[model samples]
Structures are given as C-alpha cells and as structure tokens.
Target: MPRGNPSPKLAITIDPDVHENILAAAAREGMSVSAWMTAAAREALQRRAGLAAVAQWEKQHGRFTTEEMNEARRSVQAQLRTSRTVRRPA
Candidate 1:
C-alpha cells in the first residue's frame, strides 16, 4: 500500500476462528490483515454516514414518492450507461 499514513499501533483480542477467517480473507484480497480491517472499518463508517444523512433528509422532506424513486432509478441507469467506456476497433 502507498504510504503517508501515521502508523499508531494498538492491540486487541479476537477469537482464534475469527483470526483465521480474517487471515484468509486478507490473503485473498492480497492485503495485510490490518489493511483489510482498515478498509472494512472505513466502508462501515461510510455506510452509517450515508444512512444518517438519508434519515436526516427524510425527516426534513418525507420519504420519496414512487415517481421520484422511478426518476432516480432512471437517472442512475442513464448515468451508468453513459459512463461506460467504449472500445474502438483498431
């Protein structure tokens, strides 16, 4: 992994089975166990943040209407289609 991270070390305890699982998963991803844990923790935090933001929005404006949801779906699909790169015949 690229550096520039301030490495602060800490120790924690985990079950042997969980430790083995983490080792296997980290190996599969070609990441150190610490890196895999860091990535997973970051993802978990982001997901929680997104959920909190949506909850706050829903409190301000009631949940989205069906039409609004449909529009969002269409917008995302269009974006996905437009964002794909096309290869040309050489």
Candidate 2:
C-alpha cells in the first residue's frame, strides 16, 4: 500500500454495539465520532509501525543479554554523571 494521504472517503463496518460504545466514548471526550475514530486509527497504525521497526532492528543487531544490557546501562549512567553539571550563576 502506498504511504501518503488517506482516501477522502472510506467505509468501515462495525458491530452496532461496538459503534455505540465508540460514539459514547467520543462524546465523553468532547470529540466528534469522526475525529475520535481518526485519532484512534492513527495511533494504532503508528504503534504497529514502531513495533515492526523494533523487530527489524533486533533481527539485524541480535538481542542483548541481561549482562550486556546492564553494562550498557552503567556506561550510560557514568557518561551522564560526567557530562551533567549544576548551573552556575549566569
């Protein structure tokens, strides 16, 4: 599928109960159903994309061991401690 602007007109079918629940939730949030649904769709798409990217990166780099991860965290902490400073009088 091409990645760009979405179709101006699209149709989706949901169970009536589910649709009613969504409408009620949207009303509670003070958003029109269309806006609420659009936001929900976008968030789901972005989360899926993020998970896919992470999976690809892990496949390429391989997963780190617990020891390796702990060492990396320590190294980062040490670096931050060295680099961070209290603000002095301007």
Candidate 3:
C-alpha cells in the first residue's frame, strides 16, 4: 500500500443473503470477513484510481494507440504467467 495511516473501526449490517456471500468469499481467500472486506475495498479504490488515470490520459492524448493495447496485453499475459507460477502455501 501507501504510507502508514491510523487504523479505524467500521461496523455495518447487510442483508443476510449478502452476508453469506461475503462469508463464502472470505473463506475462499482464507481471511476473516473484515480482512476480506478491507482487501476488496482497497482493490476497488485502486481500480478507481487506475480508471481516473486512464481518463486523464485519454483527455490529454486521445484514445490509446494499437501499440499501447498490445503492450497492455503483453503485460497482462506476463502477470498471469507469474501468478500461475506461484504456489499457495499449504
């Protein structure tokens, strides 16, 4: 992440059905519900930031070029390959 920040507590209630889905997702990730939720929130923020950057870039330089698209594809493929090579600890 980023620089250190003070921890804060948040509490909220969701529909039982949605809660169950969250529980399942947490279990799949081997994390507590709170941890899973925090991770999800972080990911959402990162995606939003990425989208904003892309929007700004597009506004400044028009749409992405074909070369940029191919470069992005290559980067994604490389990341997939690296991730696949990593094994989860038992």
TM-score of each: 0.63, 0.60, 0.71
* Candidate 2, superposed: residue stretches over 4 Å from native: 1-7, 64-90
| Whole-structure CA lDDT of model 3 | 0.89
Per residue, candidate 2 scores C-alpha lDDT tens digits across 1-90 of 868987575689999999999999888778878888888899899989977986898899998689987997899899878756643221
Q: What's the ranking of the predictions by TM-score, best on top?
A: 3, 1, 2
**lDDT per prediction?**
0.84, 0.83, 0.89
RMSD of each: 7.1, 11.1, 5.2
Best by lDDT: 3
- Model 2 weakest lDDT span, ten residues long: 81-90
lDDT of 1: 0.84
State in Å the error of residue 73, model 1: 8.3
lDDT of 3 at 52: 100
Better of 1 and 3 by lDDT: 3
User: Which candidate has the top score in TM-score?
Assistant: 3
Query: What's the CA error at residue 21 for candidate 2, in Å?
Result: 1.6
For candidate 1, report its TM-score: 0.63
Q: Per-residue lDDT for 60 in model 1?
A: 100
